[model samples]
Target chain A: MSDKSITRRDFLVKTAQGASLAVTGGLLWAYLVRQEAKAQPYALRPPGALAEMDFNAACIKCGQCVNACPPDILKLAPAGANLPIGTPYFEPRTGACIMCPDIPCLIACPTGALAPELKDINKARMGLAVIDIENCLSWKGLRCEVCHRDCPLKGKAITLETDPRGLSKHAVFRPMVNSDYCTGCGICEKACPTEVAAIRILPPALVQGKIGDHYRLGWTFDTEITQDFKPSEQAPPAPETSGGKPAGMDYLNDGGGL
Target chain B: MNTPADLSHSKLVSRPLGARLWSWRYVVLRRLSQFGILLLFFGTAHWAWEWPAKTPLLTGNLSASELFGRIPMADPFAVLQIFLSGHVLQQKVILGAAIVLGFYLLVGGRVFCAWACPVNMVTDLAGWLRARLPIPAMFVVSRNIRYFVLAASLVLSALTGLAAFEWVSPVGMMHREIIFGLGAGAMALTAIFLFDLLILKNGWCGHLCPLGGFWSLVGRTALVRVRFDKTTCTHCGECARVCPEPQVLNLKRLEETGFVTSGECSNCGRCSPLCPEGSLAFDLRPLIRKHGAEGSISSVRRTK
Candidate 1:
């Protein structure tokens, strides 16, 4: 073979090699991105953050939000943290978001990863706080209501539901989270007195469930209660009399056979 | 013509200490540029360094940043990838990307790789060590492979609905991890270092970096370029020896164009300082035009 020219077999082998290498590398790189993008579903983002998928796509991973945070609670997730690399997140257990009135982090965000439309910090939903009933001091018939007391929205976000203990003079007040008012700022989680934090913050998508439109409670005033099922106009005929003894035997009037 | 013996590396080393340090002026400036950028970001984030207006001096990593609470800057290639992923970026980030794009269009695009990229420091160290270690290359790959990788990154970003290269880029990993805090991102840097040091020479930047490939394409219309004087050149091969992207130093092409014409030339200022014949120097495109016209007139007079 000439030094410059290659045989057809050589050309085929080279092409095959290049194609296989490209396919292998492309698959591995794609897998890495997929894993990184969905690494931590439970990670709590800064206030006004977009939905998880949108946040992942939109965040440039600059950490400006981390700098703007007044309480220094926000951190850009480094690699191996199991969150998307360089994306800003906060751990409520250590340093919860203070729910700054100004919402500096949201304002500092160059991208709309933290939605700019969020003017009121009170409405920002970073995550949902879910109480572990088994471990909660309030649920165990105690007077501890630290979570409710420390909630930024106070009575509106978390209301106490009074329940009388069985035959006991004292009552237990359970802290109930109102989803409509709860901002998920995580101040309540930080205030919980439990050793391991009974009230923990979680991404709403991970914990919140939707009630589909298929079912409706008729008792509720909002439910229209459409009469989709109607009864037949003519009722069934009355049962036929078995005998002429006034349709049935009168046990009380019958004489004793004995 | 002067011989190669007149401009040996030994002669440079034998100069006075001040003169010898002067020879490394570009290298020192490059290191300062790289670390100084990192320091500004780190100090603002960690130490709360603020401007007179009480905003951060510089916030964010190299991927994106806000300077003095007002000016926005972003990586154009990264933004492009994100755009290709079907995300409608906010006006701030889009404007930031445009500003950066326009700046790189004025200067050479690969200026970021040589001056600002933290990964460049790691790769440069690996290259320095590789030259001294006598390690044999384990493989050979064409430099054009980076262009292919660049193409694939765009295609994959569209296909996957994520910025494909940003997710796994060692450049992002090194800078972000350093400024924020250390993490497993260092592992990627280590892999690139070893690959460049032992497996291949200048493997990451020269052969496989899609970001570098993107910048190389942008560099085609750059105003600043390395001017080459063919008459003074002795073909001693000194400039090519020190060059990271040595293929850009093709003597025949330089002789024809009177300047480094290839977009792949990074304008790193490495070859210019070390040129034995003093043939290579940084020149503006407009100045080169005037010089070309004057040289043509002089040559016409000589013919007469």
Candidate 2:
């Protein structure tokens, strides 16, 4: 712990090296984890799901999506250890939603979180959920194939993009879908739990057609769907010394605790 | 690095150990974690260093679970994978937590709050910087904010099918902002750093950071912890002095059993390292068969 053991300069360099090593080690662990990892995608979409939410800001992560569906097609989770929280998905354990008419799940949402229309009921309106370059399991150098076969937006939203550079030894892992033909079926959305969904639904009501959030801000942040968190109406006042307490009471002040 | 024999031989020497039945924790777990973190570093470095050379926008490993339906409702990493995929507030949260928890576990909690998380580091820097700048008045928010956040995230997910806060959540916002709002947020971040460091020492842990709140609570049930020797009791308040947060002493009290202030401790071990008496050593275990088995702990406050 002494600076004399290693010069300050040496310590900084070692820290940098340690930082790199630590990160590399973690990623290696993930890959090693992938080697033994067993979970796989459900082969089909639940029949009862309404339109899915977008990848980014679409769903508010309220857990209502999971509650609404009786078939247990929905599950909510956030990112990380025991982080069983945000971002709802479909499990389809006992029963799939089966593209039920009237989309019971969508109707339950108090917040239009899910699209009002079911995927096959008519034309779906969700925008496509895109994969990120940083964490797309495929991008992480692993070969993942859950987005394709499981997509309700099968032909359109959950398709693939190929490597034009011809560097990859295995180029056959292609899965892309057409956005125009795709309905914002949450099959892809509900299915995604990895850091990001390979495919997602954009709910038409929140997209261009009827999606409206001040239309002006829409011009700037089109990528964003709903604009919530507008300062809680009863915003509490910042906490401070109460009752105009004598300046001596504030522990942060000179005379208070010192 | 060799164990500091000299440091171990202070006035308050730890009585030599006999065949204690169990410690449950191991230094190698940390080593393995370190090794793991190292691999992740290289992977990301490889990704960043070789990005232009080879990029795969779609189609990852078929072997690994893709989006959800692939594995019913099991694989925990499945949801996490989706979160970190960088589409939303995709930060290296898993990696950050692992490295910090892993590396620091070998020593203490410094890594959890320092080495791994960019946000914690940044806030720590801000907490440090405030000493040099026109410090803003610091404020303390509800400690349960992270749970509130976790709850909100779940509620939001159910409502939207998306992680709504992944953008607003500090970690999420930091990740997205860095990649997308890089240019727009430079000055803002700098100001935040200064404010956080100078005005709110460890504000991310004490006031902000939902994740820290999350881990601190769970980690309290940790297999091992720092144990303080009372035979050489000086009550110097040294542990209290070096401590970065309130409630840690009471939290560490053996009587409290397995971190009474579980969520409060960051495991930084600052107090242990700084003690002149060398009275503190890490101890671990769940609550014993009987309460107050250790008698009144040195860490107990007058009120608690």
Candidate 3:
């Protein structure tokens, strides 16, 4: 501690030092939490919470939503406990969001952390429910419609899709989630009768897979509109890997059969 | 060898527990307010009667509350973070924050730190224990650091798109963890206590907490302030001894301006009761001139 008064230079230096230190610390913190941000670890946010990035910014960690929840399902993440401290999350395995008619939690959120416009709880996209085909009893040739039965949106969100293979003696009812209708309420996940629940709600970030933009689906382009849609009379080129089209394809014969 | 101020202070300290408790009236009130608020939260969370499991009276947590589904109470700092982070400020949140801000404007802002914040009780306990223990002052922290801390948190919130400090705020941590049994946040609370007890006395609240700093800004224009009656004063210096922010009660500053104008004052009334000459009093007056803001200004009130 210096006895001399702080010169203008001293103040400037300290400010610069402090600012730099803080910036570095903040960036480091954001980076450390980036992985956690990507995967919410089955932590279900209250209805209408913006996507993970926006919600983190918007939520003040007020815990008002937790109080508003009648089922006592909502709980704020403890400091240094996963999913960013003070942000509310629920484990579906414990107790799922009941999709209350009035949606009390959204009304309770002071910050638009929970989207105020989301008056309909059915529209909540907390996560996407995906049925594990390998572990699902219905997929294993057993009659298990537990998930499909308990879905809040029922017919719209979770519907039975029959197997095209037609190997079963009886009808195969495989529960499939329609992403458009599934609110990711986790009701189906909660209701699954399997030892390890077959249907699980996964955060949107994890479940939504992307295909490379370069790999265009050829059929998507209208054949009527494309100038290059000339029906070729000549033989097709040899395959690049195999050097020639031998057993698999004789383009002329295939075209004639089609 | 002790001065007359020390003699009176020692006498006050030496008095029986009952007499001393009566003497410190405001302290008792503040403690009761802090502890009472905490108990309400604890009871609502953990101890409601099952049979009479009617709607709980107080249902909210530390960051915000709604009483009887009508009254909306919020922590101004927490709400402000949301706004600063580019969140749409809903009408209810705005009104709730305004109500809190308005209350602080009347009573003085640092009143929250003294009367409501559970963390203050912990730090105050640490301060009390430090007084009795033979602890040596380890270092000095400039109180201006709080303003910097406030600035940094605001910047971080804007940049990171989060209520940045709420992630680690010991105040929120203690409130939540105290009820939930401090699973992971125990270390943070323990560190704060130890920091106050051993390192810099009043380190966290006095020098570091951005929330306290924010309230101090709100406290600047507050109507209630400490007024020094210079005419009746002996230069006993007892007011400075117990004062949390001793710089607020600087003799030269008081002589120049009759009121302690720094919003940093918690209005804890620790100085007033400790004053041997009864020169210090909490008064309601217009803050025409804040001595801390403009240096060496003459007293606005009539000088004795």
Write down the TM-score of every candidate: 0.90, 0.38, 0.82
Highest-lDDT candidate: 1
- iRMSD for every model: 1.0, 16.2, 2.7
DockQ of the candidate models in sequence? 0.67, 0.03, 0.41
Tell me, by DockQ, which candidate is best.
Answer: 1
Estimate, for each residue in B184-278, the C-alpha lDDT of model 1 and write its tens digit: 98898999999999898999998999999999999888999988877666677878988999999999988888888777888888887666446
Q: What's the lDDT for residue A180 in model 1?
A: 83
Model 2 chain B poorest 10 in a row by lDDT? B57-66
lDDT of 2: 0.43
- Candidate 2 per-residue lDDT, tens place, A134-211, comes to 655655445675766676546555666666543465553455556566644455555555754544444334334554
Per-candidate chain B TM: 0.92, 0.54, 0.84
Instruction: Give the i-RMS of model 3 in Å.
Output: 2.7
Docking class of 3: acceptable
Residue-level lDDT tens digits of model 1 in A1-258: 667466777889989998898888888888888899999888899989888877887888888898899999998888788998888999898899998888999988887889999999889898888989899999888889999988988899888888887227678889988888888888888889989999988888888889998988876767667445456699966645544442333422454222
True contacts kept of 1: 0.71
Error of 3 at A255 (Å): 11
Best by TM-score: 1
TM-score of 2: 0.38
